[model samples]
Target: MRMAYLILAHDNRAQLDLLIERLLGPGGEDFAVIHADRASPLWPELRASLPEAAGRVHLVADPVAVRWGHSSLVEAIAKLVREAVRLGSEGAHLISGADWPVTPREAIAQTMREGLCHIEVRPGHMEERMQTFRLDTRWLRLDPARDRRAYAATWELRRLARWVDAARNRLGLPRSRPYGLWAYGSGWWSLPADVLAMLDKEMPRLLTSGRLRGTVCSDEHVVPTLVAHAFPERIAAHRRYVDFPAGASSPRMLTAADLPAIASSGAWFARKVDVTHEPDFLTLPDFHPAPMAHPASMRGKLPVSGQA
Candidate 1:
């Protein structure tokens, strides 16, 4: 029943602190692991603030600078999973720095049995082919109001660097495969320990394959594609409320007014929650504890549809 509470965090110190506090109170000993980016010194400061996280902190060494449209972030996450497995984690609860878990811990434990149980979306048969959605070239290009091509171009630069590495390897030089893919969506995820180990083992192959580099957000496709290819029958496709995307780098910021909308979505976790709004969210009347049964263990994973 060992659950590794894993957070793929970057430079959001305030949000991370609030999230950690809500998830693990003083002296609470739910095994946790944090894969903090090298660019951000937030991990040190956070560890100083909460001494409990000191031993639990598994800081990334030789940290690769991650870009929104780059595959480095995905690689970092995979590395974290591998480290957790090495440390003897049975399963992992994948979450973002901005997310706050609303479901009761006891219930979460009941539902997850070394298998996937976090809120996520299942890609339709046709959607499965869409491995990458370049935010600049595809959907973003269609929306004139939102254009992030300039920012996305940064990832393209990284892709070029990876191509150079591939070229050098062709020339008989010692080289390593580049982990540079664009990925996004559904920040919260849970995976069985065995699946995680398999993913970790396959990292090198996924990185070297040029097919996934062009995608704007590869996070969405990486796990699903890997899991589908590795263990299709074991995969549980649930379009529950757990897969809502938070408005972090989006054009708009999520606010208190969105609570009613969130409740209606039947999602388990909400992202990018401001400190001021978290207490209010906990006290809302619609907030019901997860059902005693494990099947309904995720907080707010009711069956509804909107943003999720």
Candidate 2:
């Protein structure tokens, strides 16, 4: 059984470079698929520069540039899932362009074998308070032709996307929570191949559902809601090691101070490490740069933060 690390990339070239190094440094048997955002010119260089350790790496085509909260995010992710299934991986780890692993490769594989990894289900919502979260305003409303790189084109469309999203909330027609099922935020998680295959089948219907149609930030809320509702019994309720704080889609950025937290979190992965801000990463005791070509096998003395 193989786990494919599915990375979604945009213009974060520096970050992407670091992420590839860490993933390959771990050096366990793993495969990867990179979906470089079509909107950026740097993707080609980034793809070309990818190190040799990323065995069987495949980059998806027909690039659609992604806006954080828009439908392009959904489309990009769905496309990856389809490719992961086609690649015949046992499961795929859905990750962002800015993420990195917190745990060793062995631990991650063990969790998967034990079935501790969560399987998501979609939920239903019908409460009055739920009306405020608009699912369709941002990416949900996106028509690829109409929404093409709106963020890069003008300040107005970006502003309009925000304004329209706020208006939807005021009117109480949030794109996602129509049926009142509690939603989960987007972060790193692992799953069985079968679960991903199921997700491939359900993608279209879930996207169009009234409960999810208005969802603006599809990352955190979309998959969790779908998993909870459709396969509640399958989801492993307890989060792995790294966890999102309440109301946060991404985890807090890791800093020098955060290393302690990273160690303790035992999270399979954590991310958004800005090398510029934390340049002394190599000096830290737990810090070790994996050879660029082989990422998964890089291991270090235990992180002090792990004790926290």
Candidate 3:
């Protein structure tokens, strides 16, 4: 079961370089597709850093400008999945630039072989909240100030939006139905090739549906929702470690102090690592660069060990 790591990155070139090294190693067969934010200027530096593993590491030809609380994140993910599927990868893991593998390569390979799609399902009420308001309608494009204003405006306008949606539903007017699929969970996942292929084929319809166009954080809902509706049996707990403190809007930046917890979490990866805050963490024995392989031979080949 060949696996593809689809990474979404905007900044932190050094961190991304480290992640690629760990995942691909000198000659590891697993393929990787990196989608750098279109707004970021670090792609050149990122590409230059991986001269040795050019064959296995690919950059998404068309990258999306991802913004927080927006659907562009889903667009970026979809782009990565498309590339991975084209490469004939059997499974694909979605991760971010700040994320690093915590599970051993062998273990991750075993999980992929088992064909589990890792994602978390939210509670019933939370899911309802996500779908209740037409948050996406407020901001149709990526503008930091506009995005922030739209987000802030939602709290004050949610009640009205809900009433409008309810009235439209009762009147049998067109309403956003998210590809006629239910929304659920955090957006990150590791899915089988068949599922990814389905997504690739269906994405055009979803994008055109206008349901998800202006939705805030639709990326968090789109994939899990699709998978849950299409392949419930394949859904598994998302095994990536994240630390969200009470009342915090985002996951906390992981430091060396979190190493013990990270090791014990049984997670395949951990996120939000800052090299400046934890410079020594990257130097740990586990993160040592993999031995270089002969690039000529590894080009366009399936991972030597995990082929299905």
The top-ranked prediction according to lDDT is 3
Name the lDDT of candidate 1: 0.55
Could you give candidate 3's per-residue lDDT for residues 1-308 as a string of tens digits? Answer: 57899998888665576568667775556888999888787666655554246689888877877777676777788899889889999888898888878776777777778777888765342454345556444454445575787666655566677777788778887445543456567666788888899889777567666566535666777777777767778878788889889997588888888888888887888888754345545544443245443334333332333331
Overall lDDT per candidate, in order of appearance: 0.55, 0.60, 0.71
Query: How well does candidate 3 match the true structure in TM-score terms?
Result: 0.80
Please, what are the lDDT tens digits per residue for candidate 2 over residues 1-308?
57788888775565565566556555555677788887786578755676456465677866668766665667777778888888888867888766666666655666777544463333433222233444235443345677777534544544665677688778885544432465654435677787677767776556555443434555555556556655566677333334457987456666667777767765566666654345333233221234333222223322233331
For candidate 2, the lDDT comes to 0.60
Question: How well is each residue in 1-308 modelled by candidate 1, as lDDT tens digits?
Answer: 66677777776565565466455544334566677776677656644554345465455444455666467666777777777687777767777676666555555656667375343435443342233233232322233335466556646765775666567567886322133222223535767778878878876567667555555555665666566656666765332233235754442335667677766664455665643333455443322233222322423432232322
> After TM-score superposition, what is the CA distance of residue 32 in candidate 3 from its true location, in Å?
1.5
Look at candidate 3 and give me any clashing residue pairs: 1-308, 29-303, 136-214, 136-215
lDDT value, residue 190 of candidate 2: 72
Q: Residue 132's C-alpha lDDT in candidate 1?
A: 25
Model 1 CA deviation exceeding 4 Å by range: 26-29, 41-51, 117-187, 208-211, 237-254, 257-266, 276-278, 282-308
